[model samples]
Target: MTETSTEGTGTIEALSLVPKAEARQSMKDFKSDQEVRWCPGCGDYAVLAAVQGFMPELGLAKENIVFVSGIGCSSRFPYYMNTYGMHSIHGRAPAIATGLASSRRDLSVWVVTGDGDALSIGGNHLIHALRRNVNLKILLFNNRIYGLTKGQYSPPRRSARSPSRRRWARWTRPSTRCRSPSARRRRSWRGRWTPTASI
Candidate 1:
């Protein structure tokens, strides 16, 4: 793979993936030197392990994979990866990943964001990126509570005692527009992968 740059845009030119005989990479190759620093027993640890394990399957060079994240506990992901990445502003990971993916089709771009970051502030960017099919693997860690904010209730938190609990309950009720099965089908048909699962 090769990359070029355009003046002032800071965007990488299209990469030409001329696969040559190269040695396979191990999981250690993707592991960074940074100390794994998160609260003990946090779910992020498992998520991190899962991602690191899967990276080798892609068979891409470490330099060609990028992890972009937004502000939150999950945003710390880029720091632990031994690949090129960006720890960007709150709710902007999708937008940044879109630009990078669109500009460098040869690179595998992934976004790591949490419920508050992706569903609350970055919701628009996330939906648009999916609609445009900008070649990205987005992982939304919906732990419900804001881990970085010390257990504060986030957008996905569902508890009677949660902050603004009633407001959230009201919002969860599907309106007429959101209840249409055809609309959901149309949206899903446009994307390559859009799966939701509890971790």
Candidate 2:
């Protein structure tokens, strides 16, 4: 479904980009035996459901997909999926995923990171991964607040009260906007809304 031009050669080779699955997949197929442990009514449940429901349409083999996540409450994502995955270090999922994608050309690499994990300490790592143009599906869940630490605000969270501050606190970084004109030009990016009770 794609083409790659050989260096120093004028001919372009067509590549069947995504590997066709040997069998049709189902939501149950992707559901791991591990218990679902996120906070009740957390938006992650919806994200998990949507992903599981849609995986079948991709016609991909479960074993061929991998999910990598960093340290955070959301980083526990790998545990809920049946496919192979890694629960990696803090703010290092993208860096790790890039290497995985590079070495395993036949596997589909996905990164699941939260606002703080991807935009704060992992900012540089995330930026470079995007620059590399590697085949990685980055899923950034911007819940607006730091859910795992439970004491501070995340990068995308606007100025607001925080647990650590106990009063109105300004954001450490400028509020993140969806308008990434530069990033949008090079790749596909989309957003969705998920209602949550609390973090």
Candidate 3:
């Protein structure tokens, strides 16, 4: 915006309408001192890094932001962020985070949950949060998987399963995408294992 003064010397000065940012933090400022334990190529690492980088743009203080996570691979996300966070109960991140947000309106709460942890055990809580229109930033990492424990069914298998998939999934064991076919080979021949996709 510019305005001219005619009373004295005619002059125009530029003024910015935008407010100054509250924080001047770099991406490194958001990084926690703890180590990132996700697998070498896990997509969660990318998500974490992206969120860390994006936080600076918000100009919000790290102390005011909170991250809540439930059980599964993403539950450890809190450990990697410098902001306030909670490793909440299994499938209960939504409920816990909602309560926290409601009670402390000043705090910015973010929910981090994998497909299985959210859609299965925590389905009701997730629905409740959405139905109530609660203020929150929910990060649903829908890789369609439950990679933490091997015995549990995956998100893709449980939520959107066909009848045929149900029958097969019940019998076949669950597996992690991170495991190499060679490392998870079917058999060991001569004390050596080779890659094989066959189950």
Assess candidate 1 and give its lDDT: 0.69
Per-model tally of clashing residue pairs? 0, 0, 0
Tens digit of per-residue lDDT, candidate 2, span 1-199? 1112213121111113447678777889999999998998788888888777887877777888899999888888999999999999989999999898878777778899888898888887887776565667778888877887775767777656546574745535554533454444434344555644321
TM-score, cand. 1 vs. native: 0.74
Among the numbered candidates, top TM-score falls to 2
Q: Considering every candidate listed, which one attains the maximal lDDT?
A: 2
Instruction: Tell how far residue 91 is off in model 1, in angstroms.
Output: 0.2
Residues 79-194, candidate 3: write the lDDT tens digits.
Answer: 99998999989899989987887777656678998878877788778766654434556787766556776544663454336665455464544433213243233111112111
> Which is better, 2 or 3, measured by lDDT?
2
Clash-forming residue pairs, model 1: none
Off by over 4 Å in 1: 1-21, 161-199
**How well does each candidate superpose onto the true structure, as a TM-score?**
0.74, 0.82, 0.69
